[model samples]
Target: MNLKGKNVLVTGSEGFIGSHLTEKLVEIGAKVTALVQYNSFNSWGWIDTFDKNIKENINIVTGDVREYDSVKRIVKGQDVVFHLAALIAIPYSYLSPMAYVKTNVQGTTNVLEACREYDVEKIIHTSTSETYGTALYVPIDEKHPLQGQSPYSASKIAADKMAESYYRSFNLPIATIRPFNTYGPRQSARAVIPTIISQVLAGKREIKLGSLSPTRDFNYVKDTAEAFIKIAESDKTIGEVINAGSNSEISIGDLAHKIIRIIGEDVKIICDKERIRPEKSEVNRLWADNTKIKQLTEWTPKYSLEEGLTETVDWIKNNMEYFKTDIYNV
Candidate 1:
């Protein structure tokens, strides 16, 4: 599973975590085919932000994962595949659940089937902590029961199960990497960390947020990217669902306060009604039991929460133009 000269296809290379993963793969001498979600603008999103040398190492393909032909075509001749393309906005999923099913579920099926057809070396299916919902127990393990509290989480749950079935039935060299809340540079404003960072950077007196009591285990983007590489390089990870987390967590209110302290901003926290999820659908807590990934691979988080958040705040402050600080995104 050495990636020194292997061809790796990253399905959502234009995204936040995927962009970081692509850079990490290229650093280790992997030939990367970056599949960005095709758009009329012809933009590569965050991938475009990478340095010239890194961009040169990548072969960019504009394609839609929902289209089997496009997915199949890009997946060809690739030694490894990292499937990450999907509609990831939770609130938007509530409004358009069918879009989630079409992209997350059907798109994953297409990738799995294509991998089986091509006999690829390995395929790492990207997953989320949302699939585990509000964690039935603290430091939730992979065995924790999945409860779909939101449409987005439900879609991911279905996608995870589909990946499992593929391994059991076709015996595909597929492993699922479920990352917790990953935050860093180039992160879209839809995520909570970015939301707070952008507002604080904008010098807003009142920071608008949803429910403040929900807890989340946030992993740094760089750490999460390394975990993907580590998992893919280990034969023990095949057909296994591995977690990428710090095995630590913070309540949303506490996280916000920490960020405020880092940013040195005196902003009042305001509970925005429009920003909140439905009462029954909110994920109340999440903490990762990263024991499985530890047992399977040489992967562990290298960044502390404060260190990661400080870096994230600095990045957001410098790139304030990318965020709509006044708008509540989805």
Candidate 2:
């Protein structure tokens, strides 16, 4: 499926990864309709950072994914629908589990129903590594048993199953692209990579973080975006859940130190209890087995961890004003 002349709808285009994916689709000559959450201020989240030329090519639609009619309307006349919209913060999910259920689970339902109704050629549903609670085993594959340790993960698990059910019962042409911890420019402070870079660049002597022992398989945002395109282009990915990751693991403690060293900062690491998830709720480790995606789509991570982190640090340095470094974002 060549994307050059196709019409694509990307929900959550106002977000970090969604914005990047929307930009890439536009670059490939796809007519993209960016679905952003509506606000009275009319701000288009990270899409605002895109260049004027790219922004002009995209059609921005403001609506809530949890609303059935709104999702159905935006999904009409599109060849493919990439659903990336969801409530992603783990800490915030603990406070409002019902909101996660509405956005992540019910919102996904709306997208699937729209695709089923519209008979869209392809639907790429976004999944997260957090669904595989902690690494019961290293290099976790799609077959790994899901354990929702947090409210956020639970909601995502529900959403993922819903996507699967649609494929089985309704024969919806859906593929779930489960990405490991993706980080790059335009990332919010809720993510560890951005948090470390923002604090370090902001000249904080003591870097505050939570759960230094937890490990993750980090992939660059560009790599993840490219993987999504590849999955959409491949016929073999229908009704499948593929992973996008670099099969590399790094602990939060080591990652923080690496960021500090890269920025040439002499900072002390301090564990912030307020920033930590509850003991049982925290995922201790996650490492992806990306063999399925490699077999199905010719997708491999192009950026090494060091290379990605360097680029992220440079981006944070230039865009420090966009972030409130002193505040714990969410």
Candidate 3:
């Protein structure tokens, strides 16, 4: 499945990881149709920030994945479809559970059906590590039992199941890339790494944060993007749910401190009650067992935490205006 000159549709191309993946797809010479969520402002989000050459290579479409007609229209004539569109904020998901269900679950179904209808050569479905809540054992693998602790994770679980059913029932060429906590440039403040970076770069010494004990397996955004490409290129990945992670674990507290150290900032960590998840909803641990992806595809994390954090600090330092350091970005 060489993507070179192939018709590829990247839904949610305006988003953080989506934007990066879109860039990588373009780099690999894929004929990309980037689907940005239609808005009144006609904004392309991160795609607008791309250089002229990158933007020129893309066929940008304004559409919503939750709308079947919109997805169908965009999914048409595409050889490969990468479905990344979804409502990803955990706190926001708690406030509006139905929105998560509609956007994440229903939106994914729309992608599967459209891909099946279009006879797309391959369909790469985006997934999150949150689906394996509070990992029951170390180095969680694909076989780990899923526990949806948050509405956001539950929605993703439903979406993953939908993709699975499409693979089994419809025999659709679908693969799920379940990435861990991916962080890098263009990431919104809703994520912990961005929240810490945005505040520190905003000259805030007292960092307001949520529960810090929960450990996560963080992978660089670029690495995660490459994982998608690797999975898409491998025939063995069809109907597989593979984990893309660094095979390393770091607590939220440690991650924050690492970022602060990278920025050479003297910061105080404050556990802001408003930012904390409910006791029962917090996922206490996650460590990826990336053996499947490594064995199945030529994918390995290219950036270490320190290296990735340094790059993120540099990016957020210059792009501080995009974040509101004073507000808890739910």
Candidate 4:
């Protein structure tokens, strides 16, 4: 399962975590094919931020994951398929649940079917901690019951179940890597980390946010990407749902204050109702038990929250134009 010479296809290569994973795979000598969502601009999203040398090493494919034909065409001849594409904004999911279904659930089905048909060596299915919803128990593990508190979470739950069924019914060599709230460089403003960083860097005196009371286990993006590679290379991870996290928790309120303190900014915290999820849809707490991944693969989070946040702030400060701090991004 060594990735040194493996042919790897990453479905969401244009995204936040996906772009980072694609770069890591290329660094380790994997033949990487990055499947970017098709757009007339031919944009590669965050992958465009990579240096010329690294960008030149990747084979970029543009197609819609919702279409089986397009997915099958790209999946052919690949040794491992890393399915990371999905519509992840929880608020947007309430307005367009069907889109989430098509991209998340149906998109996963397309990858699974293609892998089964092509006899790919292995499949690494990306998952989110949102599938577990609010923590009924602390330090949620793979065995925790899933609660779909939002349409977005529900779509991911469906997608995760699909991956499990593929492993059971078709015997596809698939491993589900469920990562907690991953944050760091290149993260979209739709996420809290970027939102806070963007506003503070934009010289705003007040930071707007939603549900500061809700807590999450945040993992650095690089660590999360490494976990994907580790899981794909481990024989023990096949047919398993593993977690990638720091096994730590932080509330949005405290997290925001920390960022403000880090930036040495005098800013007021404003709770924006429009940015908030429905009362019941908001996940009150999420803390990961990363023991399974630690046991299965030589994977551990290397970045501390403070270190990761410093890097993220620096990135956002340099890329401030890419984000619009005035409006809430769903």
| Alpha-carbon deviation at 20 in model 2, angstroms | 0.3
- lDDT (Cα, tens digit) per residue for candidate 1, span 93-177: 9899999999999999999999999999999999999998888898999988988988889889999999999999989999999
lDDT per residue, candidate 2, 2-34, as tens digits?
988899999999999999999999999999999
What TM-score goes with each of the models? 0.99, 0.99, 0.99, 0.99
Q: List the residue pairs that clash in candidate 1.
A: none
Model 1 earns a TM-score of 0.99
lDDT tens digits, residue span 88-160, model 3: 9999998999999999999999989999998999999999999999999989999999999999999999999
* Candidate 3 local distance difference test against the native: 0.94
lDDT of 4: 0.94
Compute the lDDT for candidate 2. 0.95
lDDT of each: 0.92, 0.95, 0.94, 0.94
| Candidate 1 segments whose C-alpha is farther than 4 A from its true place | none
Candidate 3's C-alpha runs over 4 A off are none
The regions of model 2 sitting more than 4 angstroms off are none
Clash pairs (backbone) in predicted model 3: none
